[model samples]
Target: MTQQPDTLTESLSLALHYAANGWRVFPLLPGSKRPATPNHRAADCDRTDPWCRTGHAGWEQRATNRPDWITRAWSSNPAYGVGIACGPSRLVVVDLDTHKPGTEIPEPWHRFGITTGADVLDHLAGAHGGTITPTYTVRTVSGGTHLYYTAPDTTRRFTNTAGKIGWLIDTRAHGGYVAAPPTQIGSSSYDVTDDRPPAPLPMFLLDLLSRDQRPTPSTPNDDHNAPQRPSSRPYRPAGCGDPVHSTSAYVEAVIAAETAALNAAPDGGRNLALWVMATNVGKLINRGLITEHAALDRVLAAAAGHIAADAYDTYQAEATIRSGFHRAATKPTTSTRSAA
Candidate 1:
């Protein structure tokens, strides 16, 4: 079923939720009136409004657009290129291309915008192991700073977590633009350096640029129709010649255990049968005997026969098994009298 777009109230509610948690919100405003403004404090915006047209439009064009904008805005930039948007009350970093000019980043290189994430920076610093001196600058964005970095191409991927935020400061490169603070004067510019490119721009970023320059993807089933599954097969990992003996062994053990439990019970409750299977799978996962994905596959395959009638039943059964096992294990076992 198709989901409805969030109402303005819903969007505001979410914006408030992030604000309550101390996230900065950046509102994209169009026109030449202001260089930049904090999003949270910025007045309401409309897609049709001329001021709203300044940032990248690529984001709004995406099938699944995020209200935060940063997520979609940075989708086209270098996977390593990082962007920081500061709202009046929050700040967010994203690893996607900034929207085309008039859509996200206001004008200029907006056409050349790129997306970058946190990992990109980590790779560039060699995680502090390489000789590449990672220099950084903090330019004011509305009320926050856009942390910029100058490193070899080595840090071609952007990486950000709770504590990290920065971007690659490319000097001597045309189309180099920085987001200007609302109050700052003059066009965005950075100083050039003599350091060599640390690493080649990541292939993914290069590919994105090349693809952006090409014709848009062909539409089938009409532009208004929901997306159709592509005829091409989905990508899958290739199998090595060697058998996954460990996986086979785990599956066998689970089957044997379930069979034993089923055979031994005088009155086999569905719960008991489920517990047998789930516990076995959980044990394999805990012991590192099987990958989580493999274990899930096995569980789902086994459930096909037992709880297929009600999918929710299978979910509850699994939850019961996990909780029951943990609770039972935590309590001490009582000694029992044996009959001679």
Candidate 2:
């Protein structure tokens, strides 16, 4: 039988394949899942390389779907493996791992004789009155399963988590990476078991994953420690004599409100909505009420669903944000007051 792609040509081909499929991919060190990109301190950067254009970027920020970046990276070291940045790719992957030797299944599951992550996931699904839906799946080198799903469109965010669902089950969303097929460590390789496009994250699973992130009700004493809630009143620009509304709470409220608007913007006006969001945040940046990085990150995340749906790509979204931000930043101070 013909074996899976394993040689240098195959490795580069696999990386390119993932990139062409709209996944933001990065280089993994040869024979390991660790990122191959070298981290640098801001003071050490020359800013001459493509990776250092904005600042010293990490693997997540540098992950790319562009063919040129993919080809250059893989061609430099053909043995390097490929890793998918889950956030940029708009994926939430459930990692179901097999038990190690002598590892006892944790409490709550041990009584039920659960062994692997798959078992825990199945149990969780069964409890929800459903079964695990088949999605694009990968078999890890250690006999684990990575089930890929299209993340939900809601503004709520998710990140990497351990044992969030149940014993031996983990998830990768924003701020996570997964080694892709053909990535090898020692003799074995990651392999694709299910090649279908990712299914939308199951509602039951989404609820379970997002449950812990919800804010809990606070006791009377907690009021002192609780963050200042955003006011229901309309947001007014800073330096307008209402310094009371110029706190970080206001900046956060502005970002939250704009992102919500951006996500709901219809097809014909999504880009315009994106620009408005960026510029609105940019005005905050100009007033030093918010940092540019914070604004850009939230705006990009807000656009992730649209990008995943092919409404626009990352490059387009980023360019629009930067352009709108710069335009607002450079506007005359006198005009800034009434512009908002």
Which candidate has the top score in lDDT? 2
- Expressed as tens digits, the lDDT of each residue in 205-317 for candidate 2 is 77567542322211122235534333233222333333333235445545554554565566666787678677767877887876676566667766766655556566788
The clash numbers for all candidates, in the given order, read 50, 0
Model 2 CA deviation exceeding 4 Å by range: 1-8, 39-50, 213-340
For all predicted structures, in order, the TM-scores are: 0.22, 0.59
lDDT of 1 by residue, 264-310 (tens): 32323445545544554555565566665455444544443333333
RMSD of each: 23.8, 18.6
* lDDT for 105 (candidate 2): 63
Could you tell me the TM-score of candidate 2?
0.59
For candidate 2, the per-residue lDDT at 259 reads 54
